[model samples]
Target: MTILITGANRGIGQALAELYQDRGETVIGTHRAPDAGHLRELDVTDPSSHAALAERLGDTSLELLVCNAGVNLDQGQALDDGYPPAMWEDCFAANVTGVFLTIQSFLPHLRRSDAPKIAIIGSQLGSQTIASGGGYIYCASKAAVLNLGRNLAVDLAPEGFAVGVYHPGWVRTDMGGDRADISMQESAQGLAARFTALNPETTGCFETWDGQAHAY
Candidate 1:
């Protein structure tokens, strides 16, 4: 199976890409930084870049498309700063709009696969039932992506594609920090299991890396 992942230069995205590659799958890792070793350069924040990536792939069939590119702009921001208007713009741009654009631009490639699947890296924080505090921008952006993935599942189902939203767990990465609960390997393995089990029967599921259903 051939899989494409965004923001795979580092963090959980990198771990997932490496996991697939080790398992003998064709894994394409896309990154924003040109100097990111073997990862291809593709800025998820740029719509034109998505178009370019699609054109470059040119009808190449994709088995899985993982939208793991996202930003946590409001990390440690002060409430006194009122969430910083510009940060809100950047947060939504990278986290929400970027996911939608990636899915939209890659629809043709997805259609080429007999059993295409989309895995959106969302968060438990995105759940309205679980939400209870700060990081407003990050929370809101994740919520939006969760909603987007759910709706995309509905729209793309007739084409034999399945969409699943997942929380990668609090993995120890740059984004998750050292104090996080799980290691990158653990998250990657659990997520791989989740992805393998995703099918038309469970297309619109919002789940965790460890396989539990999530409230969203």
Candidate 2:
């Protein structure tokens, strides 16, 4: 299968891309850094970047597209301490709007595939039903991505596409920090398994890497 992943220079995204590559799958890994040796340059927040990415991967029908690029505003203070609007904006732009733009740009290529699947990496903290309410900006952005995936699943089902929202658990990456519970390899493996198991009938569901349904 041919797969495309965003923010693939490091962390979970890098691990996922490497995992797919090891399985003999063609991987188009994107990152903002030009020096990202094996990854293509892409900045999801930029429209031009999306266009360029589409051109770069021209005519390659993708079986899977993983929207793994994300950012968390470390506004560690309480929301009452005046939430950093700039951080919120950046988080939303990267985590939510970026997903929309990436999907829009790549939809045509994805349509050409016989089994197209899109998976957006979300967070368990985004679950409204299970939310304890911290990291407000990041939580809100992830929640938006979850809904985006759901809506996309509904809209794309007629075209034989499947969309899923997944939480990678607290992985030990730069974003997850050193205190996280799981390793990046473990998270990527779990996510890959979920991606492989998804079907049109299971679209619109939020799940974890381990196959458990997430609280919406």
Question: By lDDT, who's the top model here?
Answer: 1
lDDT of each: 0.91, 0.90
Candidate 1 at residue 24, lDDT? 95
lDDT (Cα, tens digit) per residue for candidate 1, span 1-216: 989999988888989999999999988899886735557778888988888888988868999999999989788878886788899999999999999999998889888889999999999999989857889999999999999999999998988899999999998988889999999989999999999999998999999999999877
1-216 in candidate 2: lDDT tens per residue?
888899888899999999998999998899898835568888999999899879877888988999999888755758567567788888899999999999999998999999899999998888888777577788888888988999999999999999999999999998888999999999999999999889999999899989899889
- What's model 2's overall lDDT? 0.90
Task: Give the Å error, residue 190, model 2.
Answer: 0.7
Clashes of each: 0, 0
Q: Specify the poorest-scoring 10-residue window by lDDT in model 1.
A: 32-41
Q: What does the lDDT read for residue 86 in candidate 2?
A: 83
RMSD of each: 1.2, 1.2
